[model samples]
Target: MTGAVRLEPVDERNLEPLLSVAAAEAEPEDVMPPVDAPAGWSLARRDAFREFHRASFGGLAGPTRTAMYAVVSGGEVVGMVRMTRCDEPGVVETGMWLGRSARGRGLGAAALRELLHAAAAAGMHTVVADTTPDNAGALSVLRRCGAELREENGKIRARMCLDSAIPIR
Candidate 1:
């Protein structure tokens, strides 16, 4: 059976391990911004990945504050989830990606549940996520999390209102 999944704060100590999982079990595009390197994870790409996480923590000084978490399961770092403050007050945008080896195992849903809880606890009134229509795995997780989904242009957007008094699922 798959182990229970949890979200731990992403920090210096665990960042390397998280990057290792991303390099070995996930495509760089799925986890980071587009890189000009070769198809595989290259040296420059790895450095960029580290910088991305580093910047995520610095969001507090900017207009948008972002919080990132390492997706942990079975005592291993398998993915990441993040919540970013949106331009709208009381609203936050969320995104997540799991290593290929960890996909389709209900882990994404579990991580999203934790992310939603975090959002509510952070005093967010709404949470939103956007993905392409072809990303079936993401769509499934959003639906399972009770998000209201709609397709606009070529993107599928999911939104959910937070109510801390009630449990998610």
Candidate 2:
């Protein structure tokens, strides 16, 4: 079982652990390309990712935004999730990953449930996610997280309509 998870605003404190997970979870077929993979999350890649995070955070932010968060459980950041605005005015897209040590538990679902609620409370009515076809784990996470799924242009698109009264998990 996984412990209770907390969502913390990404900052200098939790950035390293989050990036470390991002590196460890990297795969060649990943949509985000796992940053500096093979070589692992190298220093340069880490810096660039951080810079991108800062820029994305600073750009057109609202209560609902590409809000970067560290998924904390048992006093550590086991994963990270980001919610960004989509072309649809009230829709947001989410992306997330867990470290190897954090996989196979119910943590991802619980944490994502929280993330969905956060986005809903922030005025986002829907959340979307896309995953590679071969990413079974991600597909499962989408189903378990209460997102509606579809295949489009070779990727699985997960869409979840959020309501303040909706109960996830």
Candidate 3:
């Protein structure tokens, strides 16, 4: 049960859809900043999404850059993934979120794997990710991707080498 996974660059044409998905999937305990809509969605949530989208898209600029992409599966915008900024030069840290309708379908792992492929193709030597200990879904994805795990500052950190396979934790 696999769907075609593709990466679409975040641009003006796809920006609204991305924001809508973010608003729909907002979770209170999400590791990343939430871009949720307000209860009535008249003011606060709209403003928050605007700021988040602006900052996020702005980060796409320049030579030393971070890449953010919309993860599309079966032609629907399911989520977003990115290589976040890291102090290490050759390592890219990744994170993603699936919309409510897209959860529990194994899409998260698919998206992460695609991100890993992209990172490796871009000359990244290693990839890293982190999630809370209790996030079984995320932990499962990391484990399935064969990421090496360690606990740091009370969070579970996962690292993988693009040049070789790792023992899943």
Candidate 4:
């Protein structure tokens, strides 16, 4: 694929597109009960998901340890990615979604690689991601990015060591 997409830091003007992609990517099955949800999972709660991106991208309220970015293609936003809770010092968690229209084009993996690069650049030593077992697409992306998988708490968690200099490509 051509390198036509660019990942830019999230800002107020691009929050809506990010939210749209998130909502489109999310499925009823993807919704886990809030208590059992993974950390940084406010997006799984009732209606909290709608405005969750705003806290980080709209500058409303959220941990300063988080950084969000929008994946723009042909001048339009088609996906979103985030690296959060870096205050843990060497660790960070990633979350991302490609809009319905952008799926099946290898953009998901590309976006993930970009997010991992961002995390590594920020001095993170490890990056983690989790998805329901049914989400084969997501799991594939994680595996393609060289993440090690483990089954935990009914979810598939993937972790990658960013301290190494392995290129995501």
Candidate 5:
């Protein structure tokens, strides 16, 4: 695992690259089907899926509701971490993905730690994450970050409580 990756906030100019990395890392089985699919629907029907993420991450006030950070190594974006639906004022849910080249490096764990620290500084009480039962890597990262695990509805849910004294930097 390389020890030199850095995390930075996502800005409007970086959304396209972030999406491109996410798409490249996705597998056929990773695509979630629409809850209500029409019969004989084609791939184009998945436009809504892309739009969902686009609207979530793309906008002038991108940091208001959702916060994202890029993991950079050697001056290039190698992965990203995101915190969404942060309106709770005391909790946030986080999601992350690392590009193929960045896998096996400790960057995932580092990024998660940074996110938790940021959340704590923002006066958040809990930081939550979820992963499919099969994703060992993500589970490992969450565990390493002191997340308490729970199983429900076939998913592994994890959470960490923040210590209020830490400063956000």
Candidate 6:
């Protein structure tokens, strides 16, 4: 990570780079819907990956339900972050995944800060996330962003109030 981490709205222009980064840097299971095939980026998995982003990001018509962003670091797409509106008013559920190389360099935390700022600007009152207990990196980032964590049904749920958050610049 050479430059400041930033979130670029997912669209046709940058979507390919984001996908490329994902295919090269992160595991398929970690980033997209799991394919029941082998353990690598197969053609089916690649197509599925593209479709997943396009559908979730709400292609052409723009983000209808989820706001997805290409996580760029050092002027390159390294990962992705997204937030979807929840049933509760003024609340959103966020999820993010970074490439192996981008982890531990504070890019995840920085991208998360940007996501929180965006959520707050979008009038969201609270942000929530979930991860397995074994994912220490996600846990650390969530905690750093002021999320209160609790174990529920074999998963860790994190909740953070935007009112008290101070997003990193």
Structural similarity to truth (TM-score) of each candidate = 0.91, 0.83, 0.81, 0.75, 0.71, 0.90
Which regions in candidate 4 have their CA more than 4 angstroms from the true location? Answer: 2-4, 19-51, 58-64, 167-169
Q: Which scores better on lDDT, 1 or 2?
A: 1
Q: Pairs clashing in candidate 4?
A: none
- lDDT of every predicted structure (CA atoms): 0.86, 0.74, 0.73, 0.71, 0.68, 0.84
How do the residues 1-169 of candidate 1 rate in per-residue lDDT, one tens digit apiece? 4536899878888899999999999889889889787778889999989988988765433443888899999989999999999889989899999998899898998899888888888888899999999999999989888888999998999998886332344
* Cα lDDT for residue 100, candidate 2: 71
Model 5, global lDDT: 0.68
Question: Which run of 10 residues does model 5 get worst, by summed lDDT?
Answer: 26-35
RMSD of each: 1.9, 3.2, 3.5, 5.5, 5.0, 2.4
Candidate achieving the largest TM-score: 1
Q: How many clashes show up per model? A: 0, 1, 0, 0, 0, 0
- Model 4's TM-score against the true structure: 0.75
Give residue 69's error in model 1 in angstroms: 0.6
- TM-score (C-alpha, index-matched) for candidate 1: 0.91
Give the Cα-based TM-score of candidate 6 against the true structure. Answer: 0.90
**On residues 1-169, what C-alpha lDDT tens digit does candidate 3 reach at each position?**
5634678766677767877776677552342455555553446766665555455664424343667788898887877778865778778888877787877777777777777887877878899998899988889888878889999999999998899843322
lDDT of 2 at 48: 66
Candidate 6 residues 93-115, lDDT tens each? 99999888888888888888898
Q: What is candidate 2's CA lDDT for residue 97?
A: 77
Pick the lDDT winner. 1
Residue 141 of candidate 6: its Cα lDDT?
A: 90
Report the candidate with higher TM-score, 2 versus 5. Answer: 2
lDDT of 3 at 39: 56
Query: After superposing candidate 2, which stretches have Cα over 4 Å from the reference?
Result: 1-3, 23-38, 59-65, 164-167
In candidate 1, position 74 carries an lDDT of 90
Stretches of candidate 5 above 4 Å error? 1-3, 28-64, 86-88, 164-169
